[model samples]
Target: MLRNWQEVLDLLAIIVKIPAALIMKVEPPHIKVCLSSHSHGNPYEEHEMAALGTGLYCETVMATRAPLLVPDALADPHWRNNPDVKLGMISHLGLPLVWPDQNIFGTICVLDGRENHYSPPFLQLIQQFRGIVERVLKQIYYDEVRVHEEAAIRADDAKRVRLEFAAIRDREQKALQAIKESKQRWHFALEGAGDGVWDWDMARNTVFYSKRCLELPGFPEHKSLVDFAEWERCPHPDDAATVLAEVQACLDGCIPAFANEHRVQAGGGWKWLLTRGMVVGRDDAGRPLRMTGTYSDPQAGRSRLAGTERPPGRTGRHADGGIAARHGTDRRHGKDGLAGPPGGRCGPRIEHAGGQYHPVIVEPEGSHRGYLRARRRQAADGQRAGRIPAQRQGRL
Candidate 1:
């Protein structure tokens, strides 16, 4: 019935078309059939375990790696006294259940109601049945290996999601919890998140802004990031149109999420940044009413092109011994009186859009940065920030 050894064993028993079939494998104490399609065969004791020993059917099949067919179980003097016949089996056909490795580990058998049922056609039928048994054996082995692989994958992905949720959930407290937690734990995510963390409430028609967010051109402070056109305010002219389009899609009640990483002005030149905001809460109609995510600079990612640090921006060490960004726009005040590359302003290497990573960039003010969207602080009612995070500190 099925190419699966587990299923084929049970199917062979009552194939009314074929008197009886049994599927048995080796263990230790006795020859026990795992699956039987009809009541004509033996079902071993609950605690019984099978073994490949002196048992005729099992031993012969295991030793010769072939099928044993006897059309008349009672008349054959060679096997008449055999336990199988003594047990009242009148006729029987046994096919070795061989694995892909050519190991005869079990048997698929059919018992007949009459003598001499082992005709050419019936023998051929048993041979055909053997084909199914062999394949099912192979599949059983394959399924075991496949199961291991799938379990490994599930474990790895679950670990990643678990960590991500842990981080995101950290934002439950202090309005600035996301910033404090990142600095304390990852310390490098700021470099990957790009700049200007923001929150948009589609239903309330309000958007929350941060200091660095105000620095990005497309949106103004204490006011809507859009006024007939939000694109004009975006520092990166190239990405403005797409950003606006994504914004509308996120707010249209069609899609409850939006995320984009593109270049934007940071006091001077364009720098890469990752912005992620998802609907933290939704309405009855499945519409997104609120969203929140982090925004940080990604200078370190830009520096590690091809694992070769390209000397860009300017070279001045932070008081904490971090390199001053040599490229891109960095408007943050530095101890050396130079604007270092803005932290978290570099996007992911190439087009790798999704991944949680943090690169250590120490700021003079005692903060580190990287890219990661961990859990937000647990709101008394379970909510996120009412304002954006503070600017990058030391370890740049």
Candidate 2:
């Protein structure tokens, strides 16, 4: 764009028969030659500057906002000592260029070394080119305004997006806090009830045991997590199949809840435990995702079923007594003939045989020692009774 303007100045100088033609710009206290004619003998160069208000020809045209012509600066007293005289440019013709806003931009002018009045034809030609320059300035000013407006709009959209994301983050933080608080309350309630708690995550096939739950099976209190395979090893071999089948039924939604009494291997022989649980969490397809349960000592309630004291001559005895007969004592007709609580009289008779403690039940007269021999035979034969095992025979 500026290259085209430089050509305009060059042609103007040739047609007007002048030594210099320039487009000058005002920058505060200085006036610069924005573009200078390319003709020979043209003294002014592009980008040359002179101090403003120094009686220069272009300065006068800008100050008055009109055309300026000087036939001979050496003859006119008003311009005789002007700075142009040093350049030997005595004759001048110039027109002021203004923006669309009516503000002075600069001057378009021609300067001559000889003293002669500029012709009207030359004056009209420069005036026509001045209109072209002002029109181009208008386009440049509008383009700058449009660019600034678009930048402002983009900044507003970015600010709105940042605010929306901040709002979403705040909501998620509140929800997580609420969930944490609820879990704390649930754990507190379960612990206070004196029940050992267990939580199973089906998706991960892992189980988490509370401190009390670990202690129930003679495990360390700090041991909290176990894999499914490890947990399956806890139940006694005789009871494992039934316990597992009951648990699977509940998980498959066939039963509303799981309640089973099973024997689990403990440090002190086998211990009977009552475990109750349900599917506490499920997926969208109704498949179990998580389960929670409690382990409780059921022996406390079964202790009352050990039977009341028999008559003086009567002995509570049955041939098909199964495992319960082996665990219970006949207080009336035994060799000791001691009448008292069932477990109190019968509990001390646990005999160490075949690598495990076998509880020997004292039957009626003539069968007391015979029953002991039979129990030893059963232990040797690896025969197991189906009734629930007792942790403490007297209490349960």
Candidate 3:
């Protein structure tokens, strides 16, 4: 009986351009759709009826035994993927077509390619058709041709819900994949710059220092690295005070957040490092949450510059005494200070390299700003000594 009802509704809905609508029977143990615009195209064999399962959402309306109208499939949390929806049909209107005894015989439905909130024309059409379908169903009941349509409606509802769930799961999987690829791309770009990066988690008080950052500090082999405390212990005492002061000023928001070039004495030799940073972002309430920065070693520039625009390497003989060893390698990890590499090559001498360390040490044209020069070197006895090298008396 439901099969025959479905056959009529399906043909009518298609001919009228109303998307999949259902005529359901509101009875106990069923309350399903007897005929559906979808089921109309297919044979209503018992196996086929069972197979329809919950393939559509109209059965849901029937199961609830209420006249439901879903205007926009895309906007509706329910029926978002109804076949009519997948077919680009959007508006839906369903009126319960009941029998003479107030028993819901089925529903008169209409669908549109565009969304609607049930207009006057649609309401009038529903009233007319429901009156017709209901009267026909009552006559059939008297004829004993009435088929229970409640089961069909419930089955369609179940299917619609399943399809909606599948769509959600597929969307989430795609999002996760995109996120994974984005992170990989981010890391690749960060590593390619040869800049050492570090992040300070304020709440955790934990330091996240990249391997490149450690390398920039000349402590690439450090078994462990901590925050400011551990790092300050290795900074040249004289430079430590100024470096810490500048860092504090920036972090405290007292100064405009910015980058500064400073020399850090590592392994007894002072290496030029460019430190860049900013309070670019903040958490809610605008409190500082995390700080990120990068450091780059510019010693390579010194070697590279010497070969480029400079007078020929002129060895300077100090008028004082001992030979001012221009070739020097200082590797100081605080505790041991500066350790020489086998040969007792002292630190960089002023006379050989020829320039003051202030402003730009190598570039004579670089701004002669208020920059200071503090050099760290190892003496002949291998003891690390910190001093403002005697007025460019030494050579590079």
What TM-score would each prediction reach against the true structure? 0.34, 0.57, 0.33
Compared with the true structure, all predictions reach lDDT values of 0.50, 0.68, 0.50
Task: List all candidate RMSDs to the true structure.
Answer: 24.1, 13.9, 23.1
Report the poorest 10 consecutive residues by lDDT, candidate 2.
315-324
lDDT of 2 by residue, 175-213 (tens): 888888887777678666656889888778788998777
**Cα-based lDDT at residue 98, candidate 2:** 87
| Candidate 3 C-alpha lDDT tens digits along 169-224 | 99999889898788557545665677777666655544566777777656756523
TM-score of 2: 0.57
Give candidate 3 misplaced runs (Cα > 4 Å).
Answer: 1-191, 220-225, 265-270, 301-396
- Candidate 2 global CA lDDT score: 0.68
User: Which order, best to worst by TM-score?
Assistant: 2, 1, 3
lDDT of 1 by residue, 1-396 (tens): 333644554454534355456666665556666666634444332234545454456567666777776777567777776666655666777767777766656776666556745567656766787786676668888898799999999999999999888777665565477668765454244423445555655444456666565644333455434332232244343333334434444444444555555555544455555455555776776555566655554453441211122234422222122122222222233333443333323211111112211122222221212111111233343665343343442211
> How many clashes does each candidate structure show, in the order listed?
67, 2, 31
- Candidate with top lDDT is 2
